[model samples]
Target: MMPSIKFLRIIVVLSASLLFGCSDKSVDQAEFPPDKTAAVEVNGSDYSIEKGGYRWVRKKGLETETVTTDHASPNQMAEHLQPISVKSGQKVKVKIEDNPILNVFLWNQSGKEKEIKLEDDQITVPADKGTYIYEVLAEWKNGEISYTFVAEVQ
Candidate 1:
């Protein structure tokens, strides 16, 4: 009877430890593809940005897998989205859920692309009045994602 009771106690302890350990591991290894949220702020309004191409590395235990996807260009992705209105030369804020390195660019209708310098997570809208498409490339330690949004400067 004494031996049986000891054995039962050991089993219970091991079971609890295993369950807690597994849960910790799952939390450490984030979801296969992280859920990333991105947006643009214009005139105190937040506009969700469309996600574009991406190359990400997913890790599980000691193994890692690279996932790559190619999507339409920034202009193409913006075509379907209603342009967010902004004042010419106004500052537009880029809001992403995580702190990833960001590279921003603006595209004109004629297919010209120009990199925009970001200051305090904000970019100045094009001075000229017209519609413009923006591409934001965000890179984390484990992955990279491209986002797009269209803005019409009045």
Candidate 2:
């Protein structure tokens, strides 16, 4: 029996479609090469680090899915702050490991918790041009991530 013209076209189209069927992979799905970074002194002698150096260091893994509901965290991403020192009233940059830039916050240390925005990675807080311990609440997927670091108000 002879197939109709439409049926023949359909079969041809299907055959071509199969030829173009996706491979078992995609560019994005392909395993990315491991990342590496250079070590450098940050904020002078106060601290030193390598970009994206410390992360995913656990025998187990985390399963938190619902992302960044607030700006807090359970632990420190690093033992030292990115820029441990900064001048008070002067703009300083900072970033919490595995967190967003906007997630970083500044508290006045005045009993009342005031959240201030950051520039680049640091926030400017007006101090008496001396030394101070600023409680910075960095943003995390779970809540307000806090870090106690010293900044000199110069």
Candidate 3:
């Protein structure tokens, strides 16, 4: 009877360890959504960015999930936020955490979008003086996020 009791104890310990080990590994592999701030720099000054719509893939334990959220367009998103004043044709630096792949666009008031070329993590603002909405689409291996900012060219 004593030998049987000892065997049962060992089995329970081994089972518990295996369960915890698998859980820990899953937690390590799980990728959480982005919680960091994205910003833009203009002439050595940094401005905060407003987060926009996103489609992300999240993993937890043994389950995988695709999470997507829709928000207003870049031009509409800019309406609620204050615009950052910048000189016309100034070089604005894109600052996103984790250095994700970035695709930038310029949005006119008419709801049209034009892709802006990003050179060395920086984009040149429009040459004309007006208010423009900018969208920064950032992507990682697991997810993608859209960030918006309004820029007023002086």
Candidate 4:
């Protein structure tokens, strides 16, 4: 048994060594205490921080939920495209926002998935325009994400 002061000194030395880099002949595990790392959960993820317009994690096993920035805040985002409703054969110039990671899929009551091509962040929908219900899902780089935006096109 060693004095508490002496034990503390050994701990400090071991911590400094680990910070620089560990060696094959490692010190006693008791000397170096384990870090108290706690995961922050938010949006259904152990991570709760945003960086580079994306969510990140210090370790892997932790699953994270992600949503495209545009879809994440359609109401607050000015560039987000609002669902369009036009008369039959109206030929509206769909104004889509340009988002490289935004996966926009137009689904109608017909239960069909139509991937709309993005040009200038918008696409013209050639719907017959008869009170059609459509759902737009905007996906981000993270699969644990989805933005369900619905609109009625008449």
lDDT of 3 at 132: 86
lDDT score, candidate 4, position 153: 42
What lDDT tens digits, residue by residue, belong to model 4 across residues 8-79?
A: 999999999887775544333431111112122222333211111223122223544233333333222212
Off by over 4 Å in 4: 1-100
Q: Give a tens-digit lDDT track for model 2, residues 1-154.
A: 9989999999999998777775443324422221322122234433322232112221112323222223222123323444344555566555455543343333343442455665666566566665444454433333333445545555
Best first by lDDT, ranked: 1, 3, 2, 4
Alpha-carbon deviation at 90 in model 1, angstroms: 0.3
lDDT of 3 by residue, 32-143 (tens): 5657579999989899999999888866657897889999988889889899999989999999888899999888777757899999999998889998899999998888
Order of quality (TM-score): 1, 3, 2, 4
Model 1 earns a TM-score of: 0.83
- Which scores higher on lDDT, 1 or 2? 1
RMSD of each: 3.1, 9.4, 3.5, 14.2
- TM-scores for candidates 1 onward, in order: 0.83, 0.37, 0.81, 0.33
Question: Model 1 — which ten-residue stretch has the worst lDDT?
Answer: 24-33
Where does model 2 exceed 4 Å of error?
1-85, 101-110, 142-144
lDDT of each: 0.88, 0.43, 0.87, 0.37
Provide backbone clash counts, one per model.
Answer: 0, 14, 0, 3
